[model samples]
Target: MSDQELFYLLALLKVDGVGDIMAKKLLTHCGNAESVFKAKLNQIAAIDGVGSSLLKKIHDKSIFEKANEELEFIKSNNINVSFFQDENYPDRLKHCIDSPVLIFSSGNINLKNRKLISIVGTRQITSYGSEFCKKLIEDLVPLDPVIVSGFAYGVDIAAHQFAVENNLQTIGVLAHGLNQIYPKMHKKYVAKMEENGGFMTEFWSTSSPDKENFVRRNRIVAGMTEATIVIESADKGGSLITANLANDYNRDVFAVPGRVTDKYSQGCNNLIKTQKANVLTSAADLIYILNWDVESKSKAVQKQLFVELEPEEQKVYDFLLKNGKEILDFIALQCDFPIYKISGILLNMELKGVIRPLPGKLFEAI
Candidate 1:
């Protein structure tokens, strides 16, 4: 599509009473976005949701001029626009019921990766949730999965941080446009992501991050992945909305279990009990369900270790391998080193890619 056509399509998305479904119908009836803008009142009204009043409002030339101004504003910001028919549009989200007619993006737009997974959970996360997210990313990094999240606090931030630390690609789906990052504190992280991954949104640059927009954003998160995994959620958390949308999209849903008494875990346990989501026990379960080739991943892990580790780091590694997995306290005791010294050694070992730390203050030979 030409730049002018993309501008018109984005303008249609900003119109009142025009949603994805209706916009799609209008686009089908009229050949392209330019044709839709020039269509007669009766022609537009013939579509299902278009009424006489709506058609008259859409027919006003002033509205088209405002849309033109909006397009000019978008151009001034250097943002790229992708319509539904564009080859770079995400195919996974295209099949959804309310797929956006236009998407505004910055940075990479590759969605053909088969091992995409969406990690969603409560904004108010617990210590358990944070540890789970860290370990899960560490395991999946070896398999080279593309992590997707909302880039919100708690679980979302943890997921993105882990992905970056492990040098994996990740994508953040925003409720608002790319003009500003919500919560503002995440600006640095978002900038880093643009270099390594990308940011995507359905709304234009002027769209504000309103509460209602989040409900719309949740559908894209679910639609864009092969599976949705909820780490921790309350009974009525927004994570459940993504899981429900995943079910509607016929994508697999998985939930990590927590203590039944913990309020944060109630939603996940309930989802599993009601058969809405499968219970997730480990990273291996997700790999198996996705039918990824683990043997090749294992080989890659070995190669990474050989190339990344140094001689002194190999000494710490041999110690961990001889004793198997152990707690930091146990390792300190065995090595007869002070706690601070042991910590420094362990950190250096981790930096060299010699070993991995598991949840619950344990370390394991990688």
Candidate 2:
């Protein structure tokens, strides 16, 4: 897109009642944002969702002034703008119907042919959540997946720090614009994060990190990644919202199981119980379900070669091998192990690298 086209797009986005969906619809019908403004009122009105009120808003001349202001900001800041149609945009996010019309980013960012996964959870992270998050990212180092998070406190910052320490790419999906960092305290991490991955946001320079903006920010974290992992969350929070958005996008969702007594585990436990997310005991669960190739990284999959299954574990493994995937109850019944004992047996099997767990209490052999 040219400067004139970007200017029109910026102006179009500023129009009242013209959101991402509406703007996309108008742009498609008219061929471009500039064309949308020049096209006949009758032609645009003929399109779905275009109303007399919206048409009147489209005629507002003040929109150009706002667009120009943002355009100038972009030019001066050296920020990179990615239109949804551009190849530089996130691949998975493009499939989402409500994805932003444009995403503004900074830093030496690259997403081509990379495996992207989001790690999100409660802002008040616990030792259990923190340790599990560390181990998960450490184990996934071989795959070189890009770690994405909201760049908030707790799991988001932990994921970024782990990724950076491991020399892996990491992206911070900001609730506000790239002009400033939220929480102010996180400014210390800006230099290192940008060195490896950097920050991205849909908001322009004029935007602020408001309460509602964080909710809107979650969708990008969920939409761009191939999968979402919730380390810990209470029964209600932004992490759960991100998981729901991931499910809505048909992307795989995973949650770490925690004791029912723990308040932060409630949201994750609920997701598993409702079959909205897979049980993420280890990184292997995500690797298996996503079919990420570990062949080239011999050390990563070498454990499976020497993995020795016990009698009960072997029985369950054989059943899964022959039957493909089976629920916990069915596996326990077929293997003649009691429900209480089978749970431990399955956990051992998972640790042995012989089998993995899935959503809905299903399990399968490696």
Candidate 3:
């Protein structure tokens, strides 16, 4: 984008009540941010959700000052700015409706045609979580996937370290701006990380690592990646939030099953039990589910051949086999089962690799 265009885009974002979605809407209507500002009030108001108040806010002159300051920071720091429609912008993230119109980054990040997965968990990392994270990254190294994480404590840092050790690219998504690191101790690792992969954020230079910003940051982690894995988490935490956001985005979500008594494992277990995530026993499970490499024989398929299925599961499987693919409600009704029971039965079949779940609650025999 040209400097003039970038200036207008920055100013457009600074307009009160204009978030990513609204900005995109205005841009779509006016063709560009510069036009959005110059267009008559009636023309702007014609767009849906473009109210009188917003039109008034769009004219505020102070927004231009803030935008100019941020623009200067971008120019001085040489920070790479990704407009959502640009090629350098994360492809997967572009599909998310709420993704930022502009994201600032400082890294040698390359995500084109690459497998990106986010590994997140509790801040207090356990030996089990750490080891599992290492092994998972180690096993996945052969595939050369790009690792994405929050760059926070616990599984996030561990995943980055493992990826670096394995010589794989890893990108850290930060809650704050690229101007400073959140945890001061992580500063030492920054140089090496930027050597291969680097940090990304939607926050401006003036933004701090506030509590709520982390929650908003989680969406980017979940959105940009094809899958999100929760190595460990409590029943309620940011990791689970990311997993849920992944699910909402119709992305694959995996959780490592742990002993029920473990506090950190509770979130992961609940995610699995609630059928919000698949049971991630190893990298093989994710590989099979995502169909990353069709040539590789999935152990899951081999196991499914010898797996014994319960009678209820068999009935549903037989129905799907005959019908090709059916929605969840249809499967429950046709098989003479309740919705709740069918859900659990299907989940069990999925874990067994006897059936695969598709978008829109559709399921089919595999």
**CA lDDT of each candidate?**
0.79, 0.90, 0.88
Colliding residue pairs in candidate 1:
none
Q: In model 3, how large is the Cα lDDT of residue 261?
A: 100
lDDT of 1 by residue, 1-366 (tens): 666887678667667788899889988999887888888777887888888777866666676677777778678887777777777777788888698888788876566654789999999989989887887777676567778899898888788888888877788989997878987998889767776677888976668999999989989889988999999999998899999999999999999998999999999999999999987756745655666665554444454625555554565667789989988777877767654445555654554456666655567776
Tell me the lDDT of model 3 at 255: 96
Q: Which runs in model 2 stand beyond 4 Å of their true positions?
A: 299-366
How much is the lDDT of residue 353 in candidate 1? 53
Pairs with steric clashes in candidate 3: none
Model 2 per-residue lDDT tens digits across residues 1-366: 677988999999999999999999998999999999999999999989989999999999999999999999998999999999999999999999999999999988999999999999999999999988987887787678999999999999999999999999999999988889998999999999999899999998999999999999999999999999999999999999999999999999999999999999999999999999998876656777787755445344456556777888778888999999898888878888765567667655665667767776688887
In order of appearance, the predictions have TM-scores of 0.80, 0.83, 0.81
Task: Give Cα distance to truth, residue 242, candidate 2, Å.
Answer: 0.4
Model 2: which ten-residue window has the lowest total lDDT? Answer: 293-302
Query: Which tens-of-lDDT digit does each residue in 42-121 have in candidate 3?
Result: 99999999898998999999998988999899889889999999999999999999999998988798888888999999
| Minimal lDDT window, size 10, model 1 | 297-306
TM-score between candidate 1 and the true structure: 0.80
How many clashes (backbone atoms < 3 Å, residues ≥3 apart in a chain or on different chains) does model 1 have?
A: 0
Residue 87 lDDT in candidate 2: 100
